[model samples]
Target: MEVVQTIAELRARIKTYRRNNDQTVGFVPTMGFLHDGHASLLQKARSQSGLVVLSIFVNPLQFGPGEDFERYPRNEEQDLAVAEAAGVDIVFMPSVDEMYPTPTRTTVSVSEVTTRLCGASRPGHFDGVATVVSKLFHMVQPDQAFFGLKDAQQVAVIEQMVQDLNLPVEIVPCPTLREKDGLAMSSRNVYLSVEERQQALVLSQSLQQAKTFIDNNVSGSFTSEELQRLVSKHIQTAPLAVIDYVEVLSYPTLEPFEHSHSITTLIVALAVKFGKTRLIDNLILQVRK
Candidate 1:
């Protein structure tokens, strides 16, 4: 796989690909420190697009004041190997300076969807996400951009942005990959101590319990409040797990639903901090009326 650092070089290479064979491109934007979760995205892109482009830049814009921006794990050597093995054609590893150039004058933000979940606690986080993603989308201009659905809220926000702005590329949402123990895979998982890692399983376990709760209540009598409490209580069982948010909202819209019978799709999402590392996991369920 070819790695290019500058937008000029990256665009020039993509231009060559377009001119030579008109190969449709698939883009996967990531913050590096790749794992099977990232590899799953790359594989998805490779299976669909003629050329796969993966960009690894830990976006500082998305990090909050106390968040792990500087300490975020990064291993470019391993990331490149993972990308190549997954059939990535181009890897864009731009410096933050190259991406920002000057202090950014503009940013992208989607409202309502950004008002809850991770967005609520990590203020301005989604704005940073939308801003950087918009920049990458314009730079790559791929036929499709692939993203993992581990951050389903992020996916919803981006999809809303693309629809409202009429961006040309398709946004493909892939499933969240998980470890055998059921913890959702994350780059931050590196920060978990052995005990904390064991505790982190509660995030996914709570999600599973939420799913079962909904399944057993096919009568559709439960409210979002009840579901939230169900998940929150389960996570609390892990003493090390600190609840960030437990929400049961309408699927892509992310609006709260009063009764299970009202919505066709429900998303049960969680963000819990285990010691210093915060982890998120979610399940999307199709409610039967």
Candidate 2:
């Protein structure tokens, strides 16, 4: 894969791709520590577009105070190998200096969609996410951009941003890839201890339980409050896992869940911290009347 660090070089290459090559370009932006979830996104992009561009930049803008910014994790060699193996035509790896030589004055923020769940737990988190993703969208200028649904809220925020700003790129969200044991694949999973890793399954388990509750409650007997408590209680069963936030929001808009009295789609999500590692997992379910 062709790797470029500077924005100018990357833009020049993209220009060449657009002018000379008639192939459609797909972009997958990610942090350095890639896993199966990321690979799934790359594979989706590769299948849909003729040329796939993968970006590996750990944006400091998105990380908050006491968050894992410095010790997030990085193995450039391994990431490159994985990207190439996944059929990435170009890999953009820019340093902090290259991405932000001067302090960034402009920042993108999506309201309501980012106001709850992980957004409330980590203030300015979505701002950083939106800013960097907006920058990447502008930089790559791909026909389509791919993201995993594991970050359902992030997907909502980005989609809103794209629509509000009228960006031409199509935002394609791929399904979340899970571990054989049920844990959602994450870059931070490496931070977990053997015991903590097992404890992390509660996130996914709670999601499944939420689905079961929806399946059983045909009359819409359970409220969002009950679902939140159910998930929080489930996570608490694992002492190592501390609940950050447990919420069931209306899908897409992410409005606070009020009633399940009828057929509706709800996004059941949770953010839990096992020691210093904060992990997020979610499930989307349809309720029938």
User: TM-scores for all candidates?
Assistant: 0.98, 0.97
Candidate 2: residue pairs that collide:
none
Kindly report which residue stretches of model 1 are placed more than 4 angstroms away from their true locations once superposed: none
Backbone clash pairs in model 2 (N, Cα, C under 3 Å; residues 3+ apart or in different chains), count: 0
Write the residue-wise lDDT of candidate 2 on 1-289 in tens digits.
7999989999998998899888889999999788988999999999999889999999999999888899989999999989988999999999999999999999899898988988899899999999999898889999999999999999999999999999989999999999999999999899999999988888999888888887887676678899998888888999898888888888878988567874278888888999999999999887776
lDDT for each of the candidates? Answer: 0.92, 0.90
- Native-to-model Cα distance after best TM-score fit, residue 76 in candidate 1, in Å: 0.8
Number of the top lDDT candidate: 1
- What are the clashing pairs of model 1? none
Q: 200-252, model 1: which lDDT tens digit per residue? A: 88888888988888778758678899989988988899989888888899998
lDDT of 2: 0.90
- In model 1, the Cα lDDT at residue 260 comes to 80
Q: What is the lDDT of residue 12 in candidate 1?
A: 98
- What C-alpha RMSD separates each model from the true structure? 0.9, 1.1
lDDT of 2 at 276: 91
